[model samples]
Target: MTVTSARFGYDDLRGLITRVVDVKHAPEDSTLDVLWTLYDRVLDLSPERLDSPDRDRFYLSKGHNPGSFYAVLAAKGYLPDAWLDEAFTAGSRLGGHPDRTLVPGAEISSGSLGHGLPLAVGTALGLRAQGLLKPRIYVLLGDAELDEGTNHEAMAYAGATGLDNITVVVVDNGSASHGWPGGIASRFTAQGWSASEVDGRDHDAIEAGLRGHHGTGPHAVVAFATSSI
Candidate 1:
C-alpha cells in the first residue's frame, strides 16, 4: 500500500532519506524541508495521476544529486518504499542522478547543468498552448546552478513573457562558485518575476513563498536554508 509522507513527521522523513541515501550532502539537507513542504502541502500531485493530462509538473533541474527527490518520491507514494532502500545499488533504477524514463513523476530527465529551466519554460508554454493553464510547473534549482547561461536565457524569457504558471524554487545555501551579486532573489526581480527569500526549513515561510505570487508573472523562491549535511 502507498503511504503518504504526511503520516510521518520531519525527523522521521529526514532519517528515512538518510538511511536510504546513506551519504550526507548539503543540497539534500538544505532542500529537505522545502521539498517536504512542496510535496506534502503545496504541489497538486500524487501517485494516482502520474500519467494524467492535467497534473502539475516538478523538475529537479539541479540534477547533480537527487537523494531528496528520490526519498520524497518514496515518501509520497510515487514509488515503492522498498525502492528507497535499493537506491544506488547495482542494477537499481534509482541513481545519483534522476532519469525521467526510469523514475515515474519525474518531469525532466535532467542530466546536465542548466537544462531544467529551459525545458520547464517549454513545458509551461506548451501546457498553456493546450489550454491547460490550470497546471503549474515548478522547477527546483541550486544557487550554483543559476550560473549557467542556459538558465539565464530561460528565466529572462519566462519573466519577459509573463509565464505566471512557472514557479522556481532555488535552494540557496551559498554554494555558488561565483555568487550572484545583490542577492539571488534580485535576479528574478530584475527579470520581472515575483521573487521572495525565506527560510528553507520554515514550512510556513516556504509555503508562502511558493504560493504568494498569484498573478505576478513567473515566480521564484530563494530558500536560504541550512547548508549542513
Candidate 2:
C-alpha cells in the first residue's frame, strides 16, 4: 500500500524541514526539503489517481531543485531517506538534476527549462490518442525558465494544437532576475490559450487554479511566489 500525505500545508511542511535540519545538524539545504514536501504530498495523497493510466501527469520542468524533490520522494517512500543525507554525495543516483530512469516517479530528466512543456505536448497528444481524456497533463516551470526560447515555441504549439488537456504551473519567485515579460497573460490569450495569475504561496489559490479550467484550450497558471530555497 502506498503512503498518503496528511494534507499538510506548505508552512507545516516547511516546519518539518526546520526540525529535520536541526536534527541532522545540516542547515545548508533545509529550504530544499520544504519544497520537496509539495511533491511528496502530491505523489502520496494522489498516488492511486496518478498511477492510473487515466490519471493526470506532472512534468517537473524546473529541475534545478532536484535535491528537494528527491528528498520528498524519499520521505513519501518512493526513494530511501538515506539518499537525503548521501544526496549528491558522489556515486548516488540522486544528483543535482533529476534522471528519470533513476528516479522512479520523475517523468523527465529536466535540467533544461522549456523542454518539459514541449514534451508534455507529445504526452498530452498521446494520451488523447489513447482516448484518455479525463486526466490532464501539468508542467511545472520555474520563472527564470521562461528565458528559454523553446518555451515560447511550446506556447505557440499548444495554442495551435488546441490541447485542452494541458496546463502549466509557473512557479514565479520574482527572483528570476529578468522577471517575466510584461503582458505574459495577454500573450498566452492572444495565442488562443487561457492564462491566469495567482499567489504561488497561497495553497488554496494554487489548488483553485489547477482545478478550474475553461476547457477551451491549454491553460497557463502563473504563480507568484517568494521562496527562500
Candidate 3:
C-alpha cells in the first residue's frame, strides 16, 4: 500500500550520506537509508534557511543514536563536512547526541527519550497559530520511545485537534523491553490518526508510508525492520 510521493528530485544523495559517516561513528548505518529518503525526498526544509519560519521542522526524538541524523544533516549541507572529523571527540559540537544549538538544521536538542513527539505537536500548533499552515512538522522516534506516556498524550491531542500537518515516523527495530501487543500503527489509528507500516530498509516503501495518508488528521508511519520490533 505504498503511495508514491509528490515529485522531488535529488542528486548524489547516497554519496553524501557516505561522506558523513566513518568507522568510529558508524552507528548511524541503520537509519541512513530512511533519513536520506526524508531529507532527500520528502522534507521541504533546507540548510540555507535554517531560521526560516516557513521551513518544515524535523525533530529527532530518538537521540540515543544520532549518527544517521547527523549524516543526513551533513548531506543536506546543514553542517560542514569537517564536523564529521571531530564528531564525538573532546569538546566537539557534534557529541554522542544531537544538540540543536550546535547543528544548523537540528530544530531541538534531544536526549531525554519520549520528549520529541510532544514538542512536535506544540510546534505544529504554534505554526497554525501563527497562520503558517503550509509548513509541516515531522518527528522521528524509535519504537521503544512509544512506551512513554508523553507520546500517548501528544498523539491523542494531535488526533483530537486534527493536526494534519504533522507526521510521525517510528523506526521499529524490535528493541523495546515491552513489545507492543497488536502493532504500533494500530495505536495511532486508534487515537484517530491515519496510520501505516512499511519496510524500514526499503527507500520506496518508507517514502510511501511517509506520504500515504490524505486525511484531515495527523499521520503515523511505522517503518518495520526485519528484526524483532
For model 2, residues 118-161, the per-residue Cα lDDT tens digits are 89999999999999888788787876787788988988988987
Stretches of model 1 off by over 4 angstroms after superposition: 1-9
| Candidate 2 runs further than 4 Å off | 1-12, 15-51
Q: RMSD (Cα, Å) of candidate 1?
A: 2.3
Q: Pairing residues by index, what is the TM-score of model 3?
A: 0.87
lDDT of 3 by residue, 24-71 (tens): 544455565678888988888876667789988888888876766765
* Most accurate candidate by lDDT: 1
Give the candidate order by descending TM-score.
1, 3, 2
Provide the lowest-lDDT 10-residue window in model 1: 1-10
- Model 2 lDDT-worst window of ten: 25-34
Q: What lDDT is obtained when candidate 2 is compared to the true structure?
A: 0.66
Instruction: Give the clash count for each candidate.
Output: 0, 0, 1
| Candidate 1 per-residue C-alpha lDDT over 64-177 given as tens digits, one digit per residue, 9 for 90 to 100 | 767777777877777765777788888777888888888876878886889999999999889999999788988999998898999999988999999999999999888899
TM-score for all predictions?
0.93, 0.79, 0.87
State how far residue 25 of model 1 sits from its true place (Å): 3.2
113 in model 3: Cα distance from truth in Å? Answer: 0.4
